[model samples]
Target: MRREIPLLITGIVGIVFVLQYFIPHFPFNRMNAWFSDWFSIVAAFAIWLGALNLMKISFQKVFRRKSDWGYAVVIIMSFLLMAVVGFAEGKGFRDQGTAFDWLFQFVYTPLSATMFAILAFFVASASYRAFRARNFEATLLLLAAFLVMLGRVPTGDVLTGFMPEGMRLSAVASWIMNFPQTAGQRAIMIGIALGLVSTSLRIILGIERSHLGGGD
Candidate 1:
């Protein structure tokens, strides 16, 4: 019952939303609005579930005195500290200059920027590995990446002064990102939607039992 009902709800809601886009009237519109509220409630519950999981994992690591226990402690503390500050400042939401806002701005924002910068270095290293000149296709990809990077940075203009006035390197860069990449992304999204539909139908019909703890 637990498994079947959730899937039925998902399939029904998904179909209703899709149909609502075309029909745009009556029960479809009302159902869409109601579904929006329902989604919000579900989202809040999901946030709680995520927080519970974080606490569970962090506590386990802390108790075991794992290698990164200190990081876990910081994450847990940060979440709870933010929540407390948020609640203390405003009844429903945090006011600006409240303890929560201050921590978010000063600590969390800087920390997140640092984290992003660190990830950028990792990404550059990974891209360097992926774009290694093994073959013609890879070499083209490397050249494309180099061109895009150069077009964005000031140094690119300085280095590429030899490029002719008629040259449209920036247009080439934009087209590369928008046309080919966008098409690829749209294809992936279509595939994902189809997969979700298949999975939802299977769940509703009780064919897929993988979600159950026991192997299906």
Candidate 2:
């Protein structure tokens, strides 16, 4: 019964949204807008659900004194601290000079930046391995990466000054980005769209029920 009900709702909502895209009539458009607004309200509730789940797991870890429980304690405390500041300050909590804003700007942003900076080194190492000229395809990829990197700097432009303006490295880079990059991006987007449609169909047909939880 639980699975059937979810599948029925999924099928109905999926069909409605699919039709709404093609049929731009009054009722369809209005219904789509209404659903979107409802989605926002549902999202707020989902956030609270996520926070509660986090708290529950963190508290369990801390109480059990599991490995890395200190981090779990920190997570719970941070969540509570943020919630307290946000509630105490109300709507103005997000404005500059508020405790929430200061923590986000000084603490959150810097930590995020540090994480990304660390990731850059790992990405560089992976790229080096991937770009090794082991075969024709790999060699071609290596050359393309080199050209793109070189074209992004002033040195490449200066070195290629003798060539015609359109044939310069930077000009070639611009052309490659505008045409090849955009085409590749569109192909990926199309694949993602098709995948989403397939997954939605599976859920609507009750073939996928993982979202309803395990041991079904």
What are the clash counts of all predictions, listed in order? 0, 0
* Best-performing candidate as measured by lDDT: 2
User: How does each model score on TM-score?
Assistant: 0.70, 0.83
Worst 10 residues of 1 by lDDT: 164-173
Give every collision pair in model 2.
none
The residue-by-residue lDDT of candidate 2 on 117-186, one tens digit each, is: 9998999999999999999989988888888888989888999999999999999888878898889999
Residue 34 in model 1: lDDT = 89
Per-model CA lDDT versus the true structure: 0.79, 0.89
Per-residue lDDT tens digits for candidate 1, residues 1-216, read: 776666677667766777888897798868877888988999988998888999999989999999989999998887888887787777845568677777878998998999988998999899989889899989988988887877677666566567873355665567678888789899999999999989867765557757754433
For candidate 2, which ten residues in a row score worst on lDDT?
Answer: 207-216
Q: Candidate 2: where is the Cα deviation over 4 Å?
A: 178-183, 207-216
By TM-score, how accurate is candidate 2?
0.83
